[model samples]
Target: MSANKKKNLNSMEEDPTADDSDSSSEDDDDDEPHPDAYTGNEEVEIDFEGRAPTDPDCHGISQLLQRVFLRAPINTMQMADMIIAQNYVGSVICQCEPDGAESDMDDDMVEEGTIFGITTVINMTAKKDIACIEQLRGYIIQRAEKNAPDSVLTHLRDVLGNEGRPVGFLINERFINIPAQISVPLLENLHKEVLTAKQKGMQFNFSYFIMIVKFYRKEARKGKPAEDTYTNAEEEVICSKAVNSFEYSVADECDVGMSGDWLEGDATLTPYRKIILLDAKDLPHLIDDIRNYISGV
Candidate 1:
């Protein structure tokens, strides 16, 4: 990745946590609940609601996608709209409103909803004609061709190019600090939603799943070489659940987020993107693994 792109990605990824920390320090010094106070640690009832994306959600969805795509030249707004239009798949994470809350708030007075996380699947084979989908497909293929080994490259081509076997691009994104516990319900619900959609004759009958997962490569330590670590640690469960899978690193073309302060001693961190291809049948197993991993089983 170019230096500018790396800088941009790092800024986007780190700014939220930095701002949160600042807000927390300020909140701790005061006894009052300020408008901008951080209450992330407080116990509150939240819901993993399944809802279709609407016009108002386009901006938030696009913002979440920016972290995934980095500085890639994909029209995330259009991609968000596509996800919204599909409507049959995906779920959004939101804080539940208390019962007996007044419904008289004006549109302008109401705050813009926060989309804590989203997990969904997009039909890459069936929706290849869409502009943003086409862009995403071309981008993935380009990166794989440039960085992946010949074996992985051949496998990717066979899977994505096969007309009879549809593939789903699984999207799992959230704020960097969102707890893994949230992922368990989100993924479990996604599996159920996908099954329900298929039962209703929707086009969610995917044969293979393609995931572009984020991870960090801890720089070499002592005599040991660099090793990969999951950015979302829970995703390690998904990797373990895959039976027939192919993975390749695309860190060369992607941005590597900040590393200096987050490291210790001489060791540094290099952010990377890994493309994983797995059978769709493993979705249930993956969900189980995530639940077990998060629950510390």
Candidate 2:
């Protein structure tokens, strides 16, 4: 209500539990940033874009929301919408009316947990039915800004099928299923077809699951990593090896009714089809998988 309070409420706070819900907008005085999001930070006013700036200090805002989205009892569609609305397509963003009372702010943030918003950001445009899940993922890895040292991100265009269990991209020319009932041609089309309007553009970037195999260093087998020795692991090698052992690309696994055996039977003609334009960088890993599968390796 008062200009002084409004200014304080709009600024991000230090606790990391500040609320941002406009549910109380009907109550004139209830509109303001959660103390956690506005405290101990710059005293700048809200930007034209409601979201926080993409600054080093404010990087945790998005990460906080991402944690809430992922852990809350919500669906992917809801998560997508919330993220898009909050980010406003490159627009700055801010929290809505605080989610709880001043006294309860700490509890709310504790429930939501601490946020690390400076994840890699992505921009993509799909066409027809392009396979992008892989590309989305590659971009996350390629653009990572955090020192996660343990995770990678991936993104892709919308490519839904009759089911939505294992999300994938149109990376391979075919699909591969464990039991092998999905269709190769249809999956190919799914990979190629852009369900969302490529006219404007559609893309989602999320962290990829990490798969690591540990080998005790010849010296580490004797003790904890030497205090002065910098710990290191070859990510590229790990990425390459983990992929090499896979039997199919996201394309092949996601294709309608593709099966490892079915693809093999059609080897006389190479059923593979490049229905979608793929990120050249992620191709080698994909190619190696298909080649190995074909060789029954």
Candidate 3:
């Protein structure tokens, strides 16, 4: 993996929730200078590096995981530890600081760096013995049985219950405002890493992949029907490539604490979780579709 790759931010979107009042300008005489005259935007460059999650990254990794499993009784810290311990198949995204910025600090004393995103796969069949993994497996099954269609339920049981068919839970998580473009490189690298692990005789060989995707349905208004929006839009592209997928509302199951600004308004939105199953052989195609969708190709 490249240790210090740089990406231009010109194509990235600004935070939608950011306060625009600071940039607002008052009208001025044609000849006089306006205090907040609009200036041309400059292209910003950011350096992002991918590295194996380590002991020091648990806190940062867990924080990101918490957002995904909100109100669910999963132990995110243990899950983070498992990701770090696996070490061979996943990556955590971190910003690359300038050289020598922390030269004075001892190596051990270096701060737990910020984590921008994480992508990894957990072998559900192999890791069933783990407490957190078991908890998650049971949670998914319970939710599906309660909310998903019979077809989805039967498919999940056939795959998860059969020891010969290993299922991988793919986790793609990040902060709310991160652009979909960052996901392209992260997912591509994850595919390469998993293949390399399989070649090393690791237990990464799998029959199917299960992904829990986050999305919200915007309430209908003015005679228009409700609309659903994917929080990470690129995942929608992956869903298009899936063999089977189903969505269920989590609004009743989630705690009040899970509600955010998006849920508050006259035309309120409802949050839903979509479960998608894809053949392992089709992962490459899904990744390619995500790349194309994000690039507007």
Highest lDDT model number: 3
The TM-scores, one per candidate, come to 0.75, 0.21, 0.80
What's the lDDT for candidate 2? 0.26
Q: Whole-model lDDT for model 1 versus the true structure?
A: 0.63
Off by over 4 Å in 3: 1-13, 16-46, 100-112, 252-267
Worst 10 residues of 1 by lDDT: 3-12
lDDT of 2 by residue, 168-268 (tens): 22211111111111112222222222222223355533112222121111222356542211011122232343321111112232221221112222222
Write the residue-wise lDDT of candidate 3 on 116-234 in tens digits: 66789999899989999888888788888888789988988888898798899899976444578878777877898899999999989989998888888887899999897787879
Q: For residues 127-220, could you state the per-residue lDDT of candidate 1 as single tens digits? A: 9898888888887888778877777778888888997999998988765544566676667667877898899998899999888777777768
Q: Estimate every model's Cα lDDT from 0 to 1.
A: 0.63, 0.26, 0.71
What is candidate 2's CA lDDT for residue 30? 32
Instruction: For model 3, name the residue pairs that clash.
Output: none
Q: Following a full C-alpha superposition, what root-mean-square deviation does model 2 have from the true structure? A: 21.6
Question: Of models 2 and 3, which has the larger lDDT?
Answer: 3
Task: Name the TM-score of candidate 1.
Answer: 0.75
* Superposed Cα deviation of residue 274, candidate 3 (Å): 1.2
Give, for candidate 3, the lowest lDDT window spanning 10 residues: 31-40
